[model samples]
Target: MAQAGGRIRIGISGWTYAPWRGVFYPKGLRRKDELSYAARQVTSIEINGTFYGQQKPQNFAAWGAAVPEDFVFSVKAPRFLTHIRRLREVETPLANFLAGGLLSLGPKLGPILWQLPPSFRFDAEGMARFLDLLPQDTEEAARLARRHDDRLKGRAVLETDACRPLRHAIEIRHESFRDIRFVDMLRARGVALVCADTVSWPRLMDATADFMYCRLHGSEELYASGYNDAALDDWARRCRAWASGREPGDAERVGPRGARVPRDVYVYFDNDLKVRAPADARSLMGRLKLLAADGTPRR
Candidate 1:
């Protein structure tokens, strides 16, 4: 069996279904059922909207109850944390989101992704100041790089201290994040890079992190129209290969963090680019499972 941290644990960004972009997987499935089905097929999910704002505590609690044990959720911290507040406010929404039974997801809660906007460029002085505002690790950096960073070292600590403390994963949309120095800086500080696959430009394809984090935006030119089965299947295969310890034939060596081991990959489908995230996730999951069954090369 493919384990959470071991295999290509696939998932979608949001739970809502979009039929506009040819996504109809959730037509028959109820909301809870949709979540349950996704849990059976995929191992993880990256909650997208949590960063935009907070959700009802009861809703989060209900979500925790819908999925199976061992399923993980890679949630995005609210925009209040990364965009608007910039790690300033730590009382109302953030606190509520973390302490309101989110742990019910259990080991299912992977990392809370803090996706910075394009304006949030990588400035060593600024980032260093920001990092200094966060927490620190108990052991040395080397020993801790391979593991999770303690939330008490910087702004991350402030967030964690408030109750919604979870693993921190970051995705930078701006081109500035492509720089080697910037990427390594993130790894050095124990921040995971998000490998965003968009039609425009692919950022940090060869970057290293404790785990793999991917978002399949769209195909070559139809980025806004959504993804076809073919594109999804292709992504699924790549994810499997990464997880199975089989690098792509043309795979280039990216920078290494701590050890040189390949980072774990997590794939997410965006809601805007695609009509139905859950359906697309299911189709992608089916293809991955089929590939697993055939023991075929993930290409």
Candidate 2:
């Protein structure tokens, strides 16, 4: 198990879902205030809009302003690089993505998630090159952001508030990623292997980095099922174990566990079809004692 004093972040994949209105957000809550309200309810949120397309600097800045000082936002990398280009020759695309507006989030930015398509199999060389292209810190990210195309003339946020460490997490859907070599590669590169839980995909519970990133799409159903009390309890146990720098005894790992070191854990629920994501996240937070008496996040 991880050592004591590890941080655990619980949140939903996205906060802009229309179904979440009135269900998660209070009735008649202004759409613009939804992010703020949701931030109070959870510790972090995954910015899914960035996955679809590039956003303006102003948008990211506004999002940063909407959350609390300690609130964090994880970004989903653009589909243009993952789905369309399939991580091939994406230097310019990657640069454009960094230059777009992510830096505007500054200290509020958490991990940048790159989710591979279901058809993308594990290619050692290709995967290695892609991982090598990732920036390890905000300073390096700013350097890459400076290479953006003319699309972001005066709008790019190439400068960061501080040269803080940047984290990357990769979510693989193909069964090929189950190989131990992939986990070893992620560990060597300091990139986390996302523990994506879903009925249709392979669920590998390997801890390839100092931090654990999990995306709970659904356990019994792809994106439609809600986590029952038993499921939530199991997740809480696993999360606590991960945070303590130890793998759960029943973890489905690809490699042997190394020396234990405390690790932070980020878990997001993606079972939003029936408005279960937020509620499930909150429930898990409650189980972990992450919520205050007012139902807001404690930290």
Candidate 3:
């Protein structure tokens, strides 16, 4: 709503969780209305379905039409590229993934999250090559999408309604990614190093890009434990600091601070095992005063 320095978007990792039906969504709510309902509750949502497989262009268009104008959806790149191929010789896979209707989200598209597997350690050269393959803007993404093979000939949406800058965030699970050179490379590529909070994986909180992307999986347990009041308060404070282009005093940084420019922040809660993601997101939004009078996030 009224962010002091930069915009802060708090939301859940995904909206189609079965456990959230009666808890978050009304019992009788139609399945098709889930996205609309969730969009009204949070400023953004991380689309987890895309990580599993490629979605149809019509699906993306329908999803875009379901949300509010200010709402944003951060698409998770397919695991076929990140997990299956492990970013090796994936030009065609990457092209197919982008061409498979992501642009249909149009202006509502936010950052593209590429999550590396736990076994994938930091290889500077490999990482650099993969980052170089990523398109920096929608125009470039469209060009790359046009490289898709015959499989996507009839379905690929290569033309962007408005060519805007495309942002990417890398979520690393291996501890090797904590290297200073890794952070430097991401900074040079203008890709955000995701601040992933979890007890099972290495959590890196470096500020590398023009925006901040945070995923809170769990604090005490992975994907199960909800954030207590103290944890939410700390996150709110950090969100404010990042929005103002300043790192937290206790940040687990690797490289020296560079320019201090205000950055938009995107935070998603993934602790959905007990249906806590939505409540935690709402609480964090409340702490940040990002909710409207009706208790939904301000548009």
Candidate 4:
């Protein structure tokens, strides 16, 4: 089908999973070809490895080259900043992460997900300061990367292609982030509040930015359960509404409603256990008319 409304991308969180190898991945497929294979079935993917430690520039380049020109990869920000520092005194760590070759993804880079630990409560001042340190565009990111300490001397990639807008999203697991002030702060900085659906997370649906980031980690179970037809039908409805610049009347919001404007929507299935992530992702894409029954783009 031809392009319509705001963009809607449905995909899995990460491409590599042992359980997904013989299941999601074709039997006998080489491990090295997994990313390219998954990219063809989904519109986007969230790179989870980047969250653990620094990734080589060559790795980023190879990953970028593996996907189609239109495919996008949302990189999870380092946990050292969120888990270890708890968003405090993270200027240098954030800079080091920026210097860690994400720029090599270039056009394939999507939102940067900064997922706070469940123990990290909402602190207005601390969150505000941390948000300020994030670069709004690729050029600004390169400038920040230039400030990296001696840690990234040899492996850092501080260069970027032509300037392009960069987006950031925060996935809060603690209930303290329910404060309207937190939502307002995110809105002011244009950072998206990730709508993470899980059995335990807060699952806030506030529209704090121009685009929406959603992670369906399984409603009844954290990462093992699958979404039945009825559940996915509901999600498809909400995705369409959000893409058309509207939120469900009953949406759980911490702050006032945002202005009506077209919004791009990115949804990733993080329920990777039992190989449900890719299955649900492809199903959602099919519901959105993005993919056909035969794994081809809708025509």
Candidate 5:
């Protein structure tokens, strides 16, 4: 569907405490009114805490009622699915754990993030068996781990029918998934790569799918301290470009210093330092609105 005002959809991570403009907004302002305020301006959010455990169905229902229908929520699947199982032998406990909370997320749920632990590096045999074990309920995610081994031989596995459009994005923290060949492996399998922008790990910012997923930890400036107004404003400009496809006339020559131009980007701030995530997100959303007024770049 077409986006609002030809602008890209924008969202922050989970609602966390930030002074004035943290990830979602300031903690002091996180009352029902504040959440509603932020929700009106942004498009979606990644529910991060779900990784720890499932929430009660009442909680999910309340959340669903809170956000607008257009709003989408991407939830991190609990550790049981990604970290604990790691495609090893399936256990009833694991299945029960996933089913417990995921089923409660209801329809507003967008994607179930299967973020593998950093220690669990690429392993074909282990990953293949893991892939086979993933529950049919959760949809879409990349198997970046298994692509590394030439010893592995098989077509890219796809279970679109089982989960329908539910898909996964491979989060390649290590350099191993950096290779285009590896990314191509995911693309062929229909796994959208998770585009993460951090001072440490920057994935290739390419259009891997029509629906983009991004988690922006921080730039070199705020990488350590979390995001500030300036940092968020910069990102908002890029988001405008991604959503609308409009870029500055001198974009090619502008380099990094020019007046902010939209880059094809979707981001969620992870820099939770000093409760800055929400405040930064609010600031970022304001700048993006300004950019949208100027021009929107869409793909």
Candidate 6:
């Protein structure tokens, strides 16, 4: 919440995991209270469920109300649009997705993530066209929602409380996306290039938009590993640099330096197999002074 740097939100990728049941969620805690409990520990959460299928308006409303007012949720775009459609002829699908009640999250919604398939390579024209289809604000999203297909005829939400900016971030897996031109395209489109930490994929840190989105999916063993003290420390430092509106000096960037101005940042830990995500998230939050030493929020 410091003015020197824009809002920096640290959290786990998702909240529902059986392994996390007594580890992240307290023992004997009711299933419904899991989200509330997790929200108290971290400032934000990445809802990965949306990537699988369309959710009802009430589902989003309940989720938004379950968390604190200061908490936010970054949703994963449905795979029907990103995987099956592969950024081709997605206007209706995109509209259907937006119509599926994302606006129901209201002020609690953050960025929408589009994670490309690993085998999917980069195509400048296709990406540009896809980016052009993204709604820039909630009003545009509501308008787009009005065009939803019959699949959501009964469940569509086509209204908004007020106009607000909508942000998008893309996570690329193929090596072809390592090109600087791709970075430039994202920068031009005002979409954040997800800085994904993986063992094989191209891990880029090029700051393209007014905000940064990062996914820590384990450096050694993919989703099965945990970030040690040293790894967490390095990530915290890089996050601080990003929050200050400057790329880390050691960032493996594909493009040149971007504009220097305070920027908001979102970092989510996806290594949840062993229940290390929540712990790692809290550690990073503590390092950034968002959480006190005793696992309580600082401000």
lDDT of each: 0.57, 0.90, 0.92, 0.89, 0.52, 0.90
Cα displacement (Å) at residue 48, model 1: 3.0
Model 2 shows how many backbone clashes?
7
TM-score of 3: 0.98
Q: Give the candidate number with the greatest lDDT.
A: 3
lDDT of 1 by residue, 1-299 (tens): 36333456667776555443224444556555766665655567676667666554456556767777656788777787678865544334444445433444544567767777767766766665555433332122222222323332221211121233334567777766566776666667666667666655445555445566777665554334466877776677667656655544434334642444444667777644445455566577677663345532132
Whose lDDT is higher: candidate 3's or candidate 6's? 3
Writing each residue's lDDT as its tens digit, candidate 6 over 1-299 gives 45357888989898989999977788999999998899989988999889999888888998999998878899999998888999999999998999998999999989999999998999999999999999999999999999989999888999999999999999999999989889998999889999999997889999999999999998898987898889989988888887787778789888888899778999999999999899999888878888766777655
Q: RMSD, each candidate, Å?
A: 7.3, 1.6, 0.9, 1.4, 9.4, 1.1
Query: What is the Cα-based lDDT of residue 45 in candidate 2?
Result: 96
Q: How accurate locally is residue 146 in candidate 2, as Cα lDDT from 0 to 100?
A: 95
Query: Against the true structure, what is each candidate's TM-score?
Result: 0.70, 0.98, 0.98, 0.97, 0.65, 0.97
Q: For model 6, which pairs clash?
A: none
Model 6 misplaced stretches (Cα beyond 4 Å): none
Per-residue lDDT of candidate 4, residues 95-199 (tens digit) = 898888899999999999999999989888888888988899999999999999998888999999879999999999999999999999899999999999999
Task: Give candidate 1's error at residue 291 in angstroms.
Answer: 8.3
- Which ten residues in a row are the worst by lDDT in model 1? 152-161
Error of 4 at 24 (Å): 0.9
What is the alpha-carbon lDDT for the whole of candidate 2? 0.90
Please list the residue runs of candidate 4 whose C-alpha ends up more than 4 Å from where it truly belongs after superposition.
1-4
